[model samples]
Target: MRSAADRETAPAQGAAGWYEAADEPELVEHGAVTGLAVTGQGEPGGAAYNESAGALYAVMGALGAPMVPLEGRWWVEDARSPFEVPREEWRWHLFLRLPDGTATIDAARAEVCSGLPAAARVQHVSYTDGRCVQVLHLGPYSDEPASLARMESLMKAEGLVPHGLHHEVYLSDPREEDPAKMRTILRQPVR
Candidate 1:
């Protein structure tokens, strides 16, 4: 994997550029990625979200891996838009990508124990995102809908339909960056 900065010059599939609504959505093919995952239902940036994130980093540290930015897959029941659901009812699979060759869950757990509130709930998993339509959302999370709409419009124009939950890659830490300058990659698996 390349640093986000390096990705800008790499390729569309690898570019880490923050896109605007006027920018065209890109279709990228991704291979399988391994990571530590935790599932929860509630508004993001809340206690449950924090604890799960802490546990993931704790496990990653145990495996001697560098701390990676957080990512998440989000969804709701009945095909309702995630925005249509109340924050308290949102469901998410939050995860951190593990470095290649990281130790197995059992092996890492034996060496370092996590005391985070959601530590026991963590799981190691791998999945292929396959084909996706993605755009860079460059502002506060609250403005994601605009980015998503543009992607959806592009997907529809291309005769593609969503194949899985919506995904987000946090490129800038909201804690340190101003909300107006935050960068996030918004992706939706598509066929």
Candidate 2:
């Protein structure tokens, strides 16, 4: 049997199969990934949400960390279809992964000065998702439910239950002119 630590240290490269799922879901092992994090609840583009994301980027740059794609963990107080929830009710933790062994988060927190009030929400956080079910969603964000449904069905088949927040790695910027070309990795931690 593999030790928990052993499992965690394993490179996720061979785990790329988890990053690819078509018409179904696949289980994948993940290692630790660090993030500059901020928490907030509201529509994604709302003032508070945008500011929180802006603050994270500003702080990360100030701390001399290489820029990474934006990632998000989403959840709610009660279980319900995410599609059913009003945009205003959405809660999210927005993050950007920090480079390896860059600097202490405490030092980064202390020196964070983005001139943005949301900078106060910045914190260095690291976690290993362990195991997850994920799929690459190709197209607009609004159509994610169809992909999610396929994932849940596969999870049920594998007798898995979610143990963590719904996660997303934005592979393509939302500002792109063609929403049809947007690519997102939808991930859900499970056991």
Candidate 3:
């Protein structure tokens, strides 16, 4: 029989395979990687949903914990980032609804980040609303394939269908944690 370890490291959509962490995570303030925009929910110049959703998860990094399904608004305009890895994988990304004439996404992020701590990383934000279910996944990122399978099974059993994009909140930086023992949250938005 396959163990959890084998499932997580498996490739997922040509990227990191589905995985989960299994512990209560903590929270803290994080910075950078943000954007600004009017939340589609009707707030002018409000943050976009799904943009900078990683910020909340990043806080878990400060608390030595991980989070999942961070649904929020975010994005940065026209700014290539050094922190971002070049890949097609889903990011705990921020969404930003920009003005018709906004020059770049980074500019939007700067507008929103100004309200936050001076050191806050500017990122884009997007706005969205719907039923979303979340859970805390603990352990190595490699083991999440099984975890995701399990979550999918639960969703099926509950008669819930996936509605939006999946998300992961990285808690322990691989550089700091034992790869054999990592922490992250796997989330599937469903209805």
Candidate 4:
């Protein structure tokens, strides 16, 4: 078994298969995971979202933990199709995965008090996505709809239905990488 420190230093090994996907949709089972997470509502790149992400990072830094790739769970409130919902109405939980046996939540909370006020909103959360359909999306985020549509098609063909919010694991930093080269793992829990 790998030590926690080894896992912390090598995210791909730490996460097992959580961060991988093929260009085509495939079924995957994800076990429960614990992480530092913060919630928000608004356009993805809007101010509120950015601030929450910053706070999450600050708390992680305060814990002296290695940063992991950012992940998000996304949804909308309106009954209308998610595509039809205004971007500003979208809700999300942004998170950074923590290694098993990491610092305690109380310790994380204490660190928050000394960092960004928004860090107070951060929580150690856990959830399981038993079965999912996922794909690796390449290129600009704006082009994700096409990838999503593909996932939907796969789910339908397999007689599966959505069971939870959409999930994304960002493998490339949007601010620094060429949009054409961006890589993201898109996943949706299904039954």
Ranking by lDDT: 4, 2, 1, 3
Q: Give a tens-digit lDDT track for model 2, residues 1-191.
A: 33333343224633234234443456676778777999999987788888888888888877877777788899877677767888889999998887667566666665665356678778878867777878888888888989899888767766678989899888788556687788888988888
- Poorly placed runs, candidate 2 (over 4 Å): 1-24, 106-114
- When 2 and 4 are scored with TM-score, the better candidate is 4
Name the candidate, 3 or 4, with the larger TM-score value.
Answer: 4
User: What are the lDDT scores of the predictions, listed in order?
Assistant: 0.74, 0.76, 0.39, 0.83
For lDDT, candidate 1 versus 4, the one ahead is 4
Residues 18-82 of candidate 1: C-alpha lDDT, one tens digit per residue: 22222457777666778899999878888778777777778778777777778999888756766
After superposition, candidate 4 runs with Cα above 4 Å error: 1-14
lDDT of 3 by residue, 1-191 (tens): 23333322212221121223334221111212222412222121124322233333333233332232232322223246412533232133433223223344443334445444321454334333234334566666546566666776656655667666554555555334566555555555565
Question: lDDT (0-100) at residue 152 of candidate 4?
Answer: 88
| Clash count (model 3, backbone only) | 53
Which of the two candidates, 1 or 3, achieves a greater lDDT against the reference?
1
- Give lDDT for model 4: 0.83
Question: Candidate 3 versus the native: TM-score?
Answer: 0.40
